[model samples]
Target chain A: MRRWLALILVFTFALVAPGTNPRAGEGQAAPEFTLRDIDNKPVSLKDMTGKVTLISFWATWCAPCQVEMPHLQKLYDTYKDKGFMLLMISADDARSVSRVKPLIKSKGYSFPVLLDTDTKVVSQYNPNKTLPYSELIGPDLKVLWQHQGYTAGDEVETERRVKAALDALAAATPPAVAPTATP
Target chain B: MPPTPRAALVTAAQALLLGLGVFSSGLAAAGEGEERPEVSVSGQDDLEFRYWRDDRTLPDFPEEDHLFDYWELVNRVNVKLDRGPLQLGVQLDAVGMLGAYYYLNDVRVDEFDLHADGVTFPLPLAYANLDKAWLGYQGDSAQLLVGDGYIAFGRGLALSLVKNTNIDIDSSLRGAHAKVTLGAWDLTAVSGVTNAQQVWQDNPNKQQIRPDHWHMVSGLRIDRYGLGPLNLGAHSVVYSFADRADLDAQPWEGYGRGVDAAITGASVEAFGVAGLDLFAEGDLFLYPGGEVLGVEDNQPGYAVYGSAAAYPGRVALLVEGKHYKDVERVNAVVSRDLYEVAVGPTLEYERVITEDSGAAVNSNDISGVRLRADVAAKPGVLTPSLTLGLFRDRELGGLHFNRAPETIVHPIAGVDWIADSVHVLANAGFRVDKRDDLPGGVSLGADRMAHVDLSLGFPIGSAHGEIGGDLRYFMWGDNLNQQTDFTLLTANAAVHLGHGVSIVGYTDWTDDPLIDSVGNINENLYAAGELQLQPADGMTFKLFYGAYRAGIRCAGGQCRMLPGFDGARLSATINF
Candidate 1:
């Protein structure tokens, strides 16, 4: 038991100290990837720079993902104006990618939805390729936390984390000074 | 005398160092006039340990026979170093096992060994090795990578070297990959041999793992983007399989004309054109070796896939179709059992994939179409969706349980409602596959299936509770090769108290004869419990104890029969 504790400690310290790539959880720097959003624009982890970003990997054929989508949209609405961004990437390959845009448009989701037709992006984060996987990254692009598979009340916890990240970002940012009136 | 494991490792280390020295020097010389910024190093480690038992092992043997207590530990670490436009990455894996067993020749056994029959040798199953290493560079207009990496060309119809976790597939190319962006055209090229992962994180290993056969592969893609809503692209992949008995003694030994196959494809994507998004792709599969698995004519195969979507105001509609003839044969000669080389979209619902429905996902001769429509019934409060899919399969070989041709039709409807803290989501579908007459004007009954999946989350005082269930009923056709009709159901409920705490209960019941496990509570029912804790922002843990049955699971156009487990599991995922 002591050995197990020591092993866990070492792994945590090593990754927390100077790690850069994402294991999709705390102390990890989200991995790098490139994808095309629904509007045919390039999107990547770099877009989250200087902002709190939530990245979700889902598919059109996954039922749990659909259940989570409505909640994600609600979360985005709650935090979008407060230094927040949500990127919902589809792992639908070429078969069901076309439905991604229509579904978003119909639901009126404002977050950017990227297309990972080859599933390369999801592999970098969760090699097991669990559906509805998500990661919350801070302004520095370091992952704050991650969640796998979705439950109905899972978003309640997610909302708390998102708010904390946003508050942290807002506290760190210095308010803009008004222009001095000329004498 | 054969060298010891330590000696072998030392020699391998020396060889790797030599290769690294030469490789870095070559790249350094090419970048003589370039700037080298401060190099930053970062990486991540994922470790999973599973200790469980099958409970099927009898009490007649020592240590509870073969399928008793087993544990396996697997860890994969990826380290990346970056400086300006240059990057280098190395990934390694460490695997250890004890008392692990898998079915071999209908008998539960550990990794194969010719020296021992009765005694278990768990030491031979432990291994640690270097998985892959790669170096990459990115400029303002060009990108190049020279070691092991993933690549996909044109929706993966020609070459897709990415991971498919649904089937436990993780592979890369062991050569060079390059991409260049011109003013109006983007060109990408890759040439390498197959580099398959030796250990998997999600699947049970049954055999002694070894290196890949090193099938040579090369691909090229050219795309012209920003062409005023009309983008065009073309790509090609060439493969030369290595089918021999040398156990990779001499890789790249077969590149003759008779051992190669080429798949070339073209695609066009139009966005925002007349308020519609359209995409169409066509591919030609050319095999000069005449080694295609189930094709008798020795002629080339072709595939056509297209989709169109229109999102107007509050309503969205999408239609997609695919005609694939012998497209699945591309996987036959290239690491057939390890990974798939070309994977197109399968328009079937993935969660409800059964043996009968999964067969049509990769049929050599199949044509299908699917149409989906979503309407915003109440702005931000409610949305409903309807989908209809139809397909016909002409081929009666490989994995199909029917003897005659069949036509399949599926229709599904779903709705999403969100009101304050109470949310509801539900979906229901009906599917039927009608087989043609069996040569004597006699009817070969149809297979009919219906399923429902629903989830509800509501507030409970200051806390909240959620309930979800999936129901499926399958009626078998009058086919001699299939099993009897069956029904399957799963229900789960979770109660979330405050302060990062939750408890979940799970139950599964099935009468599917094809399934291989007896339930934990009875002959056809299973029950389990789980507790989740997130005491801090960076740490999360889950503890589960119970039993679950096994069945065939399909995803991303691939199918595999996953095994059942009955035991306790504790797992932790930490961000740091």
Candidate 2:
């Protein structure tokens, strides 16, 4: 009887043991990293403090990512003035900067093209190594939500999530406290 | 306790029951309230039957001695919930198939089992979303999640989801992630592993096959800046995977990196001139070992894809061009390879035809220039659109793999009777190939085929009834200096009684010149009917029957290798 009970316990543990990552949900601080864009300018995660941020990781070869580029432009237009900023990063080879740079010019995307030629940044956050992933972070640098895979109808979800995060932030900020006159 | 098979059976049975019990428990919350406790279930099923008989028994193609039968059934279930800041979900699907038309044997179907936490099914299939689920926490400004999910930055030219469902594959990430947003910039970092599932397995021991694990890490940062009528944006996605000796039989170190950028702008009306739109984007991938993990490499594997559809009142011209190269690189990463190059331009002219009767139709005349090269590198086809109403699709390439060039010439034409809901369509085309270079026993020299089809559909009673008929004639001329011809007629009726109830029935008949040596007229007739009922939100029950008059049966691009079959089919999908 004891042996059978022990076996059952072991099986149960196996079913529940796999998931163990720790970088999402509420109250969690984002991981720190610094990298350079395609133009060779250094960029850091800490630089965008105190503002809402939309961080996206993608590669040029992804078809759906290509389709969603113009839609991202729409979101940028609607919320940029409301403290919404986006960080775009790539893990392309440093040698093909010429190829990548010219192609970027042709597509007409309005986002900066940072480079992680060594892939140091890629390994820091995206473990599966798949491309075209996005994470939405609030003004306080907390990751509000993240999603993977781009289908025909994903733009709606992306817009809804971004707007929700922005609204929540807007609601939390207290109106400017007015100075009281001395009696 | 000497490890008897019965005990193992009992233990396995207990686990199975436990899982099913949990699944039913989740289904117990189906009423429109508080969101069903975060559990979701979905599924699909199909069944088919065919029958065939030959007038003359030829040596090469002998008639079947008995009737053939085929049927299939499948079911999928999922359950998800949250634990404090952590989330979890489990999914399972079982498939059962049976057919004796091709070879006499037992049913063989694949089994799938998936599990995750803190994540939801992405798009497409909500049951497949295992992207993120792990121990994590979130505050007002920053948050972290660990497990499986996807990330993207800029245009995902060099990196993106490797989603191709036709062959059935979904790339998933298993790892840890961190994100922080401030002002106009967002920063995120993640690390994990993939290829944790064995690519192939036999049914006897398929469950034991575990995915191969590889360590990977990546980070991204994006900042948007712009001016009036002009915007300049930049983003980068960087990732690296630790080399695993087991990844490949050969010894080699592996790592990957990529970057994408864009600049977009448009003119304002202030100048009284129509705004001139301008934009550009690109991506570069750098991974020595990317090929092993399904990442394309070299030749930039790049694309400069864009389109312009400026609107000026009732007229619009849209033009788009995309250039993809190093097509083999994608194949190098994964085992499958499909490459294509195409450029399409469309001119749409739309003017309100009539406004009184709610009748408005826009006409679209499009032409496409496409070049497709399959694995054989032969039959490099060039297809072009022709005619204002019917788009003529022709294949201008040699044959490969003893297979005829697909869609020698297909014309797409349709006229709407009552706007978009009711329509009539007619298409006629000719396809011929004189390719003398074909495998013996499969050559069709001097062969030509022409076909015409007309179909019409409209609402019958209320908003659910639909009636349609299709008539098609195929004429094969001068094949090996011989003539072969055939004609087919079909009629269909469908009624949708709302409330998830539908009934559909169709009958088809065909006549053709026989190819058998004995020489006899080839005749085929079939009738199929199906009644579908969905009493609840998550359940579908179908009762179908089919009868065929000794002829070949093929439909929906799927052809059974077995002989013709005749039988009844029943399928169902239940949530609880």
Candidate 3:
């Protein structure tokens, strides 16, 4: 077993030796997963391509997450029309997953809410399993910003990131022609 | 909430790369990030130091009788690197077990074996190992992984194969997993042997860790969506077991050992039909071994579950039903530990599960129905909900304390309200599980449980600081014949100072003799305090003291009886 571990370590180093820049890599593309939304409709990461999307990992039993959700709701309502998407993925598991949709409906949150009954998705992005974890991804599937926990007003920074991504999205595109006056 | 940009700028494939680069630079400096960094590294470190001790209050013994003093430190670090589509990750664990020595672990070992508590020490008191490593690739719609992975099939009735962190059980398949999404169809398959985590995060450490058993588990799942309002899926799982649990053998060396059992299932989901969302699944458990898991029925088991949900205006309602006949026997012979491959969601409220209620959670021949409704009394400001669950346990043996058939009726009411800076969340429930159904339909015995839990939040002085606390009370009426009734209560107060600093004081009182926990305050009480400091985002440090009680905890259809903890600990979690 020790020898086998040594072989594993040798391969590990060999894998890491080819890296060009370590610090340059902060954000990786989000793993693609398909899950049923609150309404039993399938929602996939591929559905959110070409958009600046903010993914929030939350649970019904998490008090801080409950307090932070209203702020996310405001962000969703603010940016829903701006080609900005918000995926409120619940990590409630099977125990409290039933409360996810009710909680979201009570807040009138129109953002897409996905149920991660097995906690697979949250384990991927936030290995620490921190509640109310948020990650901002640009149109290119690269994560632009990530934040953990919430302090009521932390959405200010999240909103700023969303604005920058949207502005940059608009800046990099060719301006559309204005419609001519009708006769 | 202020107004945001009217146009979200929805879709623009042409600017995908340029927009990502410009946005990356606009927020962060140049060279820090780009549309897709060639090599992105992200990792997490969780380290804990514990000073384990205990004292006894027996009349025959003196003060601090059977005193056990041990100091242990366990650290786990996992790092993931993604270069373009290629991803590699590994988790390393280091443990140091010091102090008190132990005799025979099995007690039958007349031979004296000096051990540090449960582990025998030889070379050193500290050891480190490469816990987990995996290599994978993530493309546009396809994902290929090898080394270690997690998979859950349809509602998990047939095959779940996922992590259960609550009980400190993270069993992964030490093999390969592949998935591809083509248009509206998604296909996923996995093949490997079960690899349970060696160093437990919550439980004590053990030496000479190896794979639970060389159980060759393989499965394939396929789903097709967008068939109008109907979506369909099906899955099949095959399991092969080893004849022996040998620790010295290599993984999968015993595999070509004959197939033991298989599970095949199908599921259907429908949405946006007459203001309702419906889902149903049916699975057949094939026990090819004739007599499997000590059951000589030689008959196949089956499980059927269905749920319907509706959101009408400000109200949300859901109704679920399940009938499982000998469905828990699959994979029962694969592992001598807590590694279960097939688990389906249960109707019982897992958070409020007790010793008596846990029986129904793992009952093989059980059928039940649950109805829940939530009303937004005043939208987000105030909401109230209620849930009622009913179950019939026909054949109870494993994990069942009751000897006769039983009926369970559980009703819970909850409310969530926020009044200007003050928020209150509370829930209270009483469950009755009556057994020995007489010929006239009357129960001769019953096990009852009642619980109440709540959390209150208060805004502090004008500085935006916050103060809150949580309280939980449980009373159990056990009818295990020789069991004793018990009550458990825990209360805590939290002070959240702005800028990611918080302090919490926890108090627990329990008289459950079944729980072998040493209290910090008195024989029947425990106390603890934790100070959490988040210097910056994505990093947290926690310093804790005192002890806490233990009990049976169930999550995601899986239940385990966790041991009580008594120690002083400090931990840190950093993700970057």
Candidate 4:
């Protein structure tokens, strides 16, 4: 009994220890990780420093995720020129990863996709590991908003959050100087 | 003594609620600015109440017992804890039933005994079980997992350990598993005890019970990826049973001792070559200490499976072949549960093979080939597919039966068309079974079987609802010169009544000539209606009334036979 109690105490201490938990949440700094895209190219979260980023965690087996894909594509098309980036991370395992490229091609979705076969990246962003989960990170590398699960018409709210982050980032940045003094 | 199933369920529910409350409070206390441990809780519940009556003159039970009523509630809770690289998950399933139905009383609690305070319990009408629990750690290129979890290897040809919740089948392994990746090579090792039960005795007056024994299993797999469109892998597993003396006293002593069973296999997969994909696997099974079924000097077993597919433009083609010789059915463990035993690699058209009107397809001692072709007339608008299958028993020295070999052939065609909010699907198939030799040296020739099904769904104009209908017909002729035909028709519609309320109704009619001839009973008719109210996100309430017929329900290569019912059901679901 004493040994059991000691083990429990140690486990509790470890869980509560400082810097032991690395979950990304609203107002918290987003975790950094490298992942490979469908083309087998490595991409990292630190690369997009000046753009509002929308990271969507998805899977082919998730019905809601499938429903939300087209909406994410639309959001990407509408905001790409406005300094916004969208990354779709698939949580499919190694066995089902082969189907990802075909499914995306069949659907004609042009957004960049990253493979999270081992779920290492997904676990850092969304601790619950729920599919159809999304996070909006500001240009400052802080998570501005996060949403779990999806329903019909939920994409409107997501777009609203993304636009809000984009507008905030624009307001914070200094405008470019006009080079008319030389004339 | 251990608590009753009901008491245990109630306690578990209470504890779950309390834990959620405390965790939520902790999160609130930590505030949004501070770093905190991650916790997630989610679950779903299904409640159904059924009242049934037998219409047949020759019923399985007496007339007085023909009419029965029952209610069942199933709850599933998933909890996850994550801190840095360490993660823990616990899934609990609790089912409580109060009914006079015999099927409900036959619930198997063998696997549940592992965590039920180590006390034996009777198969009660109300029971709950802890389904799965696991702890995992993820590092740069390696991982470790311990406890109950699912695992699969190499297209699941030789081994697949998974859970089928819809059919109440759980084959999770309980032990340790590890995986490591080095460059292009990935290796995995698993050592675990099968969390399943085996029936040792059959009581003439009661339901079958499981013995208190566990099976031990260990396996290793190595896979190499990124070989320029070529991948190779190999896997091997060993299974060992408990002592013979412990099993001899059991009722299944004649079934041979379960000591020393092993399977090893190699697989090859290739893609990105001329728009074609190929996969092939071969496995060999060894039984060191005699045969599994007590046969004298039984030989080893082997199986080979291969498939090839190509998709170019608007057309796709696929061909598959499989051969098995004296290979016994494989499962995560030997299960006493009637619905869970005999699990193997999931195959295409599994539902048709298992639920056919005639004799079901044999999983072992057989060789077969299948071909499928799909053509898209309008890309996503209209697509049609054709399928063909031919199978015959392999030469195994009459291990299965003394009768001559028989061959079965199946040909099927299907089409799907979707435009805007309208969708339609139709399928037609024919099956023929021919025997090489009949009893008394008489040739029975071939028996014909045919079936067709059509379904359509369309939106209801501007009402934001949908309406659907389905029609199905089947005909079969047995080798004994008996013919049977069955037809089913159903129509359903769902309309949003506005204000977060919806109403759905469905009606069904079935005509079975065989059943009618046996009991001179009337045709069966069933109807149901449901009213749903969604007051908030992730929450729903449904009130339903229906009359249903006994049928087989299948999902993920697992099937369960459900009893007929006429009932009213109320259910609520909430996730947070």
TM-score of chain B of each: 0.88, 0.48, 0.85, 0.76
What does the lDDT come to for candidate 1? 0.74
Q: Largest TM-score belongs to which candidate?
A: 1
For B340-382, candidate 3 gives per-residue lDDT tens digits of 7788878887878876677688788999999988888887778
lDDT: the better of candidates 1 and 4: 1
Write the residue-wise lDDT of candidate 1 on B1-576 in tens digits.
334446545765775575556445544654667754544455445556666665555444445464557766666666665554566667776555556555656886654331122112225555555667777776657878877877877656677777666676678887888989887788999887877877676665545355455777888999998888988999988887766443333334434324457889999999989988999999999877655444456678888888889987788888889899887887876535557777777778777888788788878889999998889888656888898989998879678867889999999998988666677888899999999998889888899999998888888897878898999999988876677889999999988786668898999999988788888899899999999876654345678888787877775566667777677766554433
Query: How do the candidates rank by DockQ, highest first?
Result: 1, 3, 4, 2
Candidate 2 chain B: minimum summed lDDT over ten consecutive residues — where?
A: B351-360
lDDT of 4 by residue, B184-247 (tens): 8879998776554221111010222343344566789998877898789999987665443443
Candidates 3 and 4, the one with greater lDDT: 3
Residue pairs with backbone overlap in model 4? none
TM-scores for all predictions: 0.85, 0.42, 0.83, 0.70
Q: Give candidate 1 regions above 4 Å deviation.
A: A1-33, A44-52, A61-84, A125-128, A131-183, B1-44, B55-67, B100-122, B208-210, B244-246, B249-259, B292-294, B334-338, B535-538
The true-versus-predicted C-alpha distance at residue B212 of model 2, in Å, is 7.2
Error of 1 at A143 (Å): 5.3
Q: Which regions in candidate 2 have their CA more than 4 angstroms from the true location?
A: A1-183, B1-73, B82-87, B96-145, B148-156, B162-171, B176-181, B186-280, B285-300, B332-457, B467-492, B506-527, B544-576
Tell me chain A's TM-score in each of the predictions.
0.83, 0.78, 0.82, 0.84
lDDT for each residue of candidate 2 in B480-544, tens digit (9 for 90 to 100): 32434565565677776655567888676766444211111223667778897755422446776
The top-ranked prediction according to lDDT is 1
Point out the higher-scoring one by TM-score: 3 or 4. Answer: 3
